[model samples]
Target chain A: DQQVKQNSPSLSVQEGRISILNCDYTNSMFDYFLWYKKYPAEGPTFLISISSIKDKNEDGRFTVFLNKSAKHLSLHIVPSQPGDSAVYFCAASGTNAGNMLTFGGGTRLMVKP
Target chain B: GAGVSQSPSNKVTEKGKDVELRCDPISGHTALYWYRQSLGQGLEFLIYFQGNSAPDKSGLPSDRFSAERTGGSVSTLTIQRTQQEDSAVYLCASSLDVGTAVYEQYFGPGTRLTVT
Candidate 1:
């Protein structure tokens, strides 16, 4: 059972434009959510994260928005750059668990110039 | 200092063989995790070690897959009698603590294991 799910398999955005990737989760117990960027043949790098108590958290050009009621979260990249093109995976953590992250299938983002 | 690093960038082994993958975590990071990545599937948790605490092997797929952490720093994941489906990129990560916003897990390039 995939607790975290990214419905979109892929997304395309124009350079310098805004890009939005959406993710959903089935478990309401998750308290912390994070987004990671992964390149080909490389490990995923942490981008940003948000807590359930907060609705949004921003870091540089990346912002994560969380809606507890909807069990939905989104990662927004402003002025999307070509370098930002990679697979984006959404992960979650709960207080009960010892921070054993649960990751989604990931969404492939492509930025076109 | 340097981030997490994994050895044996690529390994090709025959079926029914045994393979060992290694991971060196970052300095001062007590929490270590192992994950398996397969095509179309995201990171699958394999095992984790935290300080002197008992390791969590709940995510391990089967009895054939096992891991160990020595001196609470480096870890080794061993797969015995591996099947073709066991072929996947094995990734290792290190974090500061558990269930905290400080979960900025630094990851390694990963060891690509191909079971023929």
Candidate 2:
């Protein structure tokens, strides 16, 4: 079963616009959530993360908002650039899982210049 | 300051053949994880190892699939009599530890395996 899900497979937006990526989870045990960006033929790199206790966390141009009650989380990239085009995967881990990250199917973001 | 590294970036083996993939975790990192991404699918956790701790094999798909971590550094994943469905990109990742704090994992470029 897929505990984490990214419903949107692909998203397109104009450069300098805002890009929003959404993820949902069914496992309440997950307490830490993270986002990773990946380019073709490369490994995913960590972007940002949020704890279950917090609702939002921001770094630079990327922001992650979490809603515990809705079991939903989202990543927002402000002033999206063409370099932001890649597959973004959301992952989650719980204390019980021993740092094993369960990842979503990933959403491909395309920023058109 | 090297990140996780996996060997044999690409492998194409025939069905019924056995293949072994290797992974070298970042230096001094005590936690190692193995995951695979199949076509049009998300990453799937396969196994995990921590400093002398019993490896977690809960995610191994079958008895044919197994992994071993030697000297608490490098890891090897072996698939025996592999089927065509075993084709996927196997990824390795490492972190400082698996303590209470959530440590961000660094992943390797991954080893792509294709069973022909």
DockQ values, each candidate: 0.69, 0.87
Indicate the docking level reached by candidate 2: high
Which portions of model 1 miss their true places by more than 4 Å? B98-102
Candidate 1 chain B least-lDDT 10 residues: B97-106
List model 2 lDDT by residue over A1-113, tens digit each: 78999999999999999999999999999999999999989989999999999999999999999999999999999999999999999999988766889999999999999
lDDT of 1 by residue, B1-116 (tens): 89999989999999999999999999999999999899788999889888889999999999999999999899999999989999999999998874444477889999999988
- What are the clashing pairs of model 1? none
TM-score of each: 0.97, 0.98
**Local lDDT at B95 for model 2:** 90
lDDT of 1 at A103: 92
